[model samples]
Target chain A: MSVFIIRRLLQSVLVLVVMSMLVFAGVYAVGNPIDILISPDATQADRDATIRAMGLDRPMWLQYAYFVKNALAADLGKSFAFNVPAIELILERMPATLELASCAMLMAVVIGLPLGLYAGLKPKSFAGKTIMTLSIFGFSLPTFWIGLMLIMIFAVFLGVLPSNGRGATALLLGIPVSFLTWDGLRHLALPAFTLALLNIALIIRLVRSGTQEALLMDYVKFARAKGLSDARIIGVHVLKNIMIPIVTVIALQFGSVIAFAVVTETIFAWPGMGKLLIDSINVLDRPVIVAYLLIIVTLFIFINLLVDIAYSLLDPRVRLGESDS
Target chain B: MSQQPALSTATPVLQVSGLETHFAARNGIVKPVNGVSFSVSRGKIMGLVGESGSGKSMTGYSIMGLIDAPGKVVGGSILLDGREVRGLDAESLRALRGNRIAMIFQDPMMTLNPVLRIDTQMVEAIQAHEDVGRHAALDRCRAALAQVGIASPDQRLKSYPHQFSGGMRQRVAIAIAILLKPDVIIADEPTTALDVTIQGQILAEMQKLCRESGTALIWITHDLSVIAGLADQVCVMYAGRIVERGSVDDVLDSTAHPYTLGLLNSVPSRNPRGQRLRQIPGMTPSLLNLAPGCPFRERCAHATRECLEDPLLEPVLGHPTDAASAAHQVSCHHPLQTGIST
Candidate 1:
C-alpha cells in the first residue's frame, strides 16, 4: 500500500510539472510581456526601464526560467491587473470556495443518500415513485437554472432568508473556516441550500441507481432469506454494497462542484475563488490565472487520491499495489 | 409413520396445498404455479424436481414469502405445522422466515455478503432472530462454520466471502442457514455451482443435519440424480405442474407419466449405455401462449386426442397397493400400465 502511494505521488509530481510547463508555455505564447511594459502612459525611456526592471526585455526562455523559479519559491509575481502577489490573492480567496463545496457535498450526501435509500427500498410504493420522478426532474434541470429558481423562490417570493453575502452581523463562531454566510449557517442557509440543491439532485440519482442495483444482487436475496427485516436488509446489506460507487461519484464530482460555483458566486456576489478567478481572467491577470489553475488541479488530484485510499478501505478485494487480485 | 392426523405429530411441518402463483405482466398473466400441492413432515426431505421455468424456484420463494413485484400467489394454502402462512402480515412472515424457516440459494455468494466478514455477517444473522449475547452468538457462528466443514473456524470467520473458494462459500452459506436452527429449510439448487466432490459432501452434511435436527427440507432442483439418492419423496414438476409424485424409488424406477419417463430417459444413466441419449422432443411452451389443455402435451410422446383436456393426477394401473391412497400418483390420461407398450 505504501509502495502504491509512493508511486502515485511520483506520478503526480511528473504530471504536475508537465501541466505547469504547458500552462506556462501557452500563457507566454499568447502575448509579449513587453506589451504590458510599453503602456500608452509610458515614454520610450520609461518603457525600457520598466521592461528591464520586470525582466521582460530578456529572451523568452530566460523569462520562463525566472517565472518558474519565482513560482517555485511561492513568489507568483505581481498581477498586472491587481498589482498584488497572485499567490497571496488566491490564498485569500481559497477558504470561501472550499467552504461552499464542502458544505454542498455534505448537504448532497445527507439529503440524497437517505432519499435514494428510501426509494430503492420501496420501488413500487407511492413514496418511491414520487422520489424517482422528482430526481429525474432534478437531474435533468441545469444547476445554474436551479440556483436562479432557488433565489427567486427564497429571496424574492418567500422574503425570509438573505439572498447573498456572508452576513450582516459578526458571527459568534471563532475564525470562519468557510464562507462567512456558510460559516454562520444561521445566515448561511440560503446560499448553501442554493449551492446544495443541484448536487443533492445529482447524488440522489447516483445513490438511487447504486442502491437499486445492490438490492437486486444475490447477497440481498440471501440476506432476506436469513429473515432479516427490510430495514436491516437495506441498511447493512444494500447500503454497504452501494457506498463504493457513491463514494467514487461524489469524489469525481467534487472538483466540478468547485469549478461550477463560479456562476453561483458571481450571481450572489459571494466572494469565493470562482468569482475571484473569473474577475482575474476578465482583466487578464496572468499570474493570478496561473496560480488559480494550479491550485484547482492540485485539489482535484488530492481528492482523487483520497478516493483511491477510501476504495481500499471499503472493499478489501481492491488491493492498492496490484491491478489484479 | 405415525398414523391418525392430529396436532400431536407436529401437523406435517410444512403443508402446502393448491399453491397457484401467476405473473401479471404487460402482455398478459402467466400462471406458473397451477394448483401445486405437497406436504413435508418434520425430519423429511422432499425433493421438487423440474426443468427450467417449471416454477420450482417460485414455489420455494412463495414458501418463504419472498415473491415481490409482478408475481404473486393467486391461490394457495401454506400451513406451517397447522398454522396458515398464506395471508400472514409482512412482519409475521418476516419473523417466520430465517427464524422458523430459512432458504439457501443456488449461488453461495447470494447467501454471503462479499464485503462483510463471515463472522460479522453470521453473528448478526444469529443475533437478528435471537436475543443471544454477542459472545454466545459468535461461539455459535464458529460452531456452525466448523459444522459446514470449514477448517480453523476463527480464521475463516475473519476472512471475507471472496477469500473462500466457491465450495467453501456454499458451505458458509449452508452454515448461515443452519445457524438459526429453523424448523424448515428450502435449499434451491444449493449445490448447483459446486464441484461434484464438494456437492456430495454438502448433500451428505445437509441430509444428516436435517435428519438429526428434525428440520423439514424442500430441496428444489433440476438434478433428478441427486434427488434419487437423497430424497425420501420426489415430486416431479413439468411446466409448473407436478406431473408425477411418489417415493424416490417409485418415481425414478416406474416413471408413470410420459413427462417423468422422458425426463428419466433423457438423463444419460437411465438411457441405454451405448445408444444416443433420448431427449424430450419439444421445448417447454411459453407460459404466455400456453395451450388450453396440458402444458407438457407438446413435449410428451404419449400425448393423444384425450390429452387436449387437462388431466388431474391419477393412480397408475396395476398398482393395487391401496388404490384410493396409493404411494404413487401420475397426472396423465394414460399412465404406464401392466401391458401398455412404451
Candidate 2:
C-alpha cells in the first residue's frame, strides 16, 4: 500500500512538471516580455535595457530555463503590470475561491447523496417523483441565472443578508487573511447555495444511477438473502460498491467547482482567486497569471492522485503489484 | 397399512395452491403461473420441473417474497404448516424468508458478497433471525461450513468469496441455508452450474441433511435426471402450470401427461445410452400472445381437437390407473393408460 501511494505521488509530480512546462510555453508564445517593458512610447535605450534584463534577447530555451529556475525557487518575479510579487498576488485571492468551492462541494455531497438514494430505491413514488423533478430543474437551470435569482431573493428582496464582500468591513479574531469573501461565509447563504445547487443536482443523479446499478449486482442480492434489512443492504453493500465511481465524479467536479468560483466571486465582488485572476487578465498581469495557472494545474493533479489512493482503499480488487479483477 | 387420516399422517410442511403470478408489460398482463398446486411433507424433497420462463423460478421467488416490480401474486395462497403466507407485510415476510424458508440461487455469486469475508457473511446470516452472541454465531458458522465439506473451516471463513472456486462458493451458500435448518428450502438449480461430481456430492449432502433434520425441500430445475435422484415427489410444469405430479417413481415410471413423457423420452439416459434421444417437436409457446387453448397443445403429439378448450386437470379419463398411483395426478383430458397404452 505504501509503495502504491509512493508510486502514485511520483507520477503526480511528473504530471505537474509536464503541465507547468506546457503552460509556460503557451504563455510565452502569446507575446514577448519586451511588449510590457518597451511600450511604444519608451526610449530606445530603456527598451534595450528592459529587453536585456528580461532576457528576451536570449534564445527561447535559455529564457525558458531561466523561467523554470526562478519559478522553482518561488521567485514568480514582479507582475509586468501590477509591479508586485506574482506569488503574493495569487495567494491573496486564492482563499475566497477555495472557501466557495469547499462549501459548494460539501453541500452537494450532503444533499445530493440522500436524494439520489431515495430516487433510486423508490422510483416513481411521490418522494421519488418530487426529487426527480427538482433534480431536473436543478440541472436545466443555468448557473449564472441561478446565481442572479439567488442574489435577487436573498439580497434585493429579503434584505436579511449582505449582497457581497468577505464579511463585516473589519477583521475578526485580530487576523486579517485579506480574503474578506471567505470570512463572509458567515453571510454566504446566497452565493454558496447558488454554486452548490446545480452541482448537487448533477451529483444526486449520478449517485442515484450508480446506486441503482450497484443494487442490482449479484452480491447485493446475496446480502439481501442473508436477511439484511433494506436500509442496511443499501447503506453498506450498495454504498461501498458505488463509491469508487462516485468519488471519481466528485473529484472531476472539484475542478469545475474551482472554475465556477471565478464567475461567482466576480458577481459577489468577493476577493478570491477567480476575481483576482479576472482582474489580472483585464489589466494583463503576466506573473500573476502564470502563478495562478500553475497553481490550479498542480492542485488538479494532486487531487487526482488523492482520488487514485481513495480508489485503491475502496476496492481491494486493485493493487499495484497484482492484476486488477 | 392401516386406513389412516391422510391429513394427520401426512401434513405437508408447505402447500402451494392455485398460486398464479402475473407480470404486466407493454403488450399486456400475462399470467406466468396459472392455478399451480403442489405440496411437500416433512423430510421429503419435491422437484418442480419446467422449461425456462415456465414460472419454476417465479414460484420459488414467490415463496421467498422476492418478487419486485412489474410482477405480482394475482391469485391463490402459499401455506407453510397450514398457515396462509400470501399477504404478509414486508417486515414479517423478511422475518420468515431466511429464517423458516431459505432459497439457494443457481449462481453462487448471488449468495456471497464479494467484499466481505466468508466468516462475516456467514455469522451475520445466522444471527439475522436469532438473538445470539458473536462468538456463538461464529461457532455455528464454522460448524455450518464444515458440514458442507469445506475443509479447515476457520481458514476458509476468513477468505473472501473471490478466493473460493465456483463449486466451493455454492457449498458455502448451501451451508448458510442449511445452518438455519429452515422448515422448507427452495433450491432453484443450486447445483446446475457445478460439475457432475460436485453436483452429486452437494445433492447427497442436501439429501442427508434434509432427511436427518426433517426439513422439507423444493428443488426447482428443468433437469429430469436431477429430480429422479433427489426428489421424493415431482411436479412437471409446462407453460406455468402443473401438467403432471406424483411420487417420483409414479411420475417417472407410470407416465401420464404427454409433456412429462416427452421430457422423459428426450433425455439420453443410462437405460438407453446408445439410443438417439427423442427431441420434443416444437418450441414453448410465448407467454405473451398465448393461444386461448392449452399452451402445450402445439408441441404435444397426442394433442386433439378437445385440447383447444383448455382442459382442467382432473382424474384423467376417469380411470383408476394404478393402486399405488392414487396420489398421482395429470392435467390432461386424455391421459395415456398403463402398459396397454404404451
In angstroms, the error of model 2 at B296 is: 0.8
Q: What is the C-alpha lDDT profile of model 1 across B1-342, one tens digit per residue? A: 112234333358888999988889888888778889998887889999999898899999988988877888889899887789998888888877887889999988566888898888898787777788989998999989888889999899899988989999998888989997887899999999988999999999999998888888999989988998899889999777888898787777777887777777677876767888888887888877467777787876677999899999776666657633386888888787632233
- Candidate 2 wrong stretches, greater than 4 Å: A32-42, A74-78, A81-85, A168-183, B1-9, B268-277, B289-292, B315-324, B338-342
* lDDT, candidate 2, B102-173, per-residue tens: 888898865677766788778877777888998999898888888889999999988888889889999999
lDDT of each residue in A2-112, candidate 2, tens digit only:
776677678777877787678777777766656554579988998888878656688877866887899778787677766789888887666567767877788899999
Among all candidates shown, the one with the greatest lDDT? 1
* TM match of model 2 to true structure: 0.90
Assess each model's interface with DockQ, reporting 2 decimals per model: 0.72, 0.45
Task: Fill in the DockQ of model 1.
Answer: 0.72
Residue B106 alpha-carbon offset, candidate 2, angstroms? 1.3
The local distance difference test score of model 2 is 0.80
